[model samples]
Target: MPVRALGYKPVYDYRVDQLGDQGGAQGSILVAGTWYCPSMPEPLIEATSDLHAGRIDRETWVAHIAARKPYRLMPKESKDAEGHQRMMCPAEAGKVQCPLKPRSLGRGVHLPLVDPQPSPTRPLKVCRQRAITLAPEEGAEYWQALDYGDEQWQKIYFRPRNSVEGHANRRKITAWLDSLARGGQRPVRRTNRRRKTKPLGTWTPTGHLTPAT
Candidate 1:
């Protein structure tokens, strides 16, 4: 009856059992006990459970089943006691096992310092102004200033054209100029005009220079 209903497929079979409500088909109608449909592939029940747990979506689950063929039927002997078959994926199963002590690509590569010998013929030149010469008091004061104001002394003595300290100062000045240009701060640009007192005239005996009359 199951075969007929399923279009007489060789994959499926049904068993009949005598139930109370049998609609007078001799004794009992053929009731399907455990419907075996070999053609209808088994779902990835584990993957489905994973999907339910929000680990994977339906599309990914379908793709995984298609790629892995987890639904493929196995022989009875191949199946476990619980009727579960072990799904072996070729991509995962056929992976080469790594050795305990694997060979390294940089096996022969070693760090070695190569120091070049100094030229004995050519001596390094020194500036006379930069030569070390100072009185005991001057040397003491220099050392004191150096130790006391390390950063300030460095700025004053040996300043760099481009440095963090100089860049910070430039940024502050630029910000002040930008604020002034935007008319945000108090200080504004001032305009000047000249007032003409009088035209050139001949000097008389009077204190003030006046036109001759």
Candidate 2:
């Protein structure tokens, strides 16, 4: 939380708890860390749960996620000096479609139009507004600068994590060698010694290996 106050948005994999089975906010559902329309297909809400429960196969769960698109961030003007920014629901942004948002039907030409079955008797705030303003203080606590678990998040999180760890590992190795040197011990360099396999052959009584004719 302190780091967030200093303007750092943490990127992390969704723990089992973060995947919501239902809408976490008045008119929005939380998936990974982002807010989505409450009408996000039920299977998607249940995808992570089903996967962990073994009720669905990895392939099926993967397909579910593969079909999922990322949320679109609104314009720069949506935010002031503060960290708060206006974000459009996935459906409204045209990443996906919902009958609730009539314009969405025309939008998301290449995206899936989900039938929001058993439509909410009373539409939530998000379905009606199409966009929501989130602040760093509260609702956006788990919020990701990049859509969580999407290709962008992977690109943003993985490359840096790997490269940073590589630097740390190298530093540790160097420090260890320095410690060894200070103690008058030579650091042993490791070498790869591959055992060469013999070609197809027969062992003769004279302890000779004869290759096949």
Candidate 3:
């Protein structure tokens, strides 16, 4: 079964009859209205254009697959023997491995960053100015993790089920912190509007209040 988060809807598989004999057979799927070779990484998709332009050789194109980090196929509810959360690569089955590969596109070709970005979701805007408070103990861990700046830190802050805002105010605080750690500018806050008022009183010639206005 296709994973829910991927939003993958399997379409017809490519065959010789549909795409002609030269085109390879690969199952195609739609993701948020975009078609994809479910197993192909975004880098490889980009490499296809470079290959067509004669910038990268076929040998280098094939090597890109070996460098790809394995896809996460395990269900979110699944856990390893030690009761720790587990992830897996689709191609390697149960094994977990790094997905970065060395670039071999000869001179002048550049590869995308090895690490993927964190969630694109932004935190909810606050209605008022308030300090971001975190648990005293976890506060240190969060700061240290943000300072480290790696996938491991992301795993800690952006854990599954954390995307939702519940009673835990810390989630939103950590998200904003994570954004800063990833080089995002601190969000600008809107200034509060000054309250309007009517004239309060009338004054006599001596400057003493005589009556309410």
Candidate 4:
């Protein structure tokens, strides 16, 4: 967050170890600083949520992601050098369908239209709007260098991170093993315990020390 406030655009690597449910206006939910559609299913929203909380296993989380027909971001107003862009909602952009935007239906897109028509109880502005403008400040804290979960993200994040961590861990293991070979009492502290020593023999009456057999 501070990094963005400082006007530096830095891509992030996350552990996702903590629990968070930060959301934004228009019922959009924030994950890694990117906003997602409100109509996102409970399974999709809850995928990482349950896994991080230890309520679900990796396989189930993978299944949840696989089951998702996620909305895609389309550029409506192109981003300028200042890093601002306007995006169309899935309903209008034809990435996914919603009953609210009937024009998007049956456009040969593979996604399904919203089920169970909206009633007065469920009226939402997100349904009415076609596009949203995102400033660099809008999601600066969690803004991604590329769209989250896309092939670009996977390529940029995983391989380099894994390689660096792997090499670092390997070097640490080697150093600790070398310390133990030399009887280091605390390998991490880089301190060794000295071996006890004894005199070969006591001084004799003639001032000659005798060796112990």
How big is the positional error of residue 20 in model 2, measured in Å on the Cα after superposition? 3.5
lDDT of each: 0.30, 0.65, 0.33, 0.63
- How close to the true structure is residue 101 of candidate 3, measured as C-alpha lDDT? 18
Candidate 2 residue-wise lDDT, 10-63, digit = tens: 887767776754236656666666666665676876777788889899788777
lDDT of 3: 0.33
Q: Top model by TM-score, which number?
A: 4
Best by lDDT: 2
Candidate 4, residues 1-213, lDDT tens digits: the string is 566555655655556752234455454555544566666666666677777789899888766655443554456887776677777666676677776678877776568555534566755555667777766666565566564444566688788889999999998888777667355354445556575775435335555655556
In model 1, how large is the Cα lDDT of residue 113?
Answer: 16
**Where's the lowest-lDDT run of ten residues in candidate 4?**
18-27
TM-score of each: 0.17, 0.61, 0.22, 0.65
Query: How well is each residue in 93-190 modelled by candidate 1, as lDDT tens digits?
Result: 22111121122122332311111234555321111111111222221111221211123433554555347678999977876675474545665444
Q: Model 2 off-target regions past 4 Å?
A: 21-23, 57-59, 70-77, 106-109, 117-121, 159-213
Model 3 over residues 1-213: C-alpha lDDT tens digits?
223224332222222222211211122222211222234465554443455567788777555433432332322344343333322223223222223212212222232222323335531111011111222122111112121113443465455436554536776676566555345667545456586764444224555645643
lDDT value for model 1: 0.30
Residue pairs with clashing backbones, model 2: none
Candidate with the larger TM-score of 3 and 4: 4
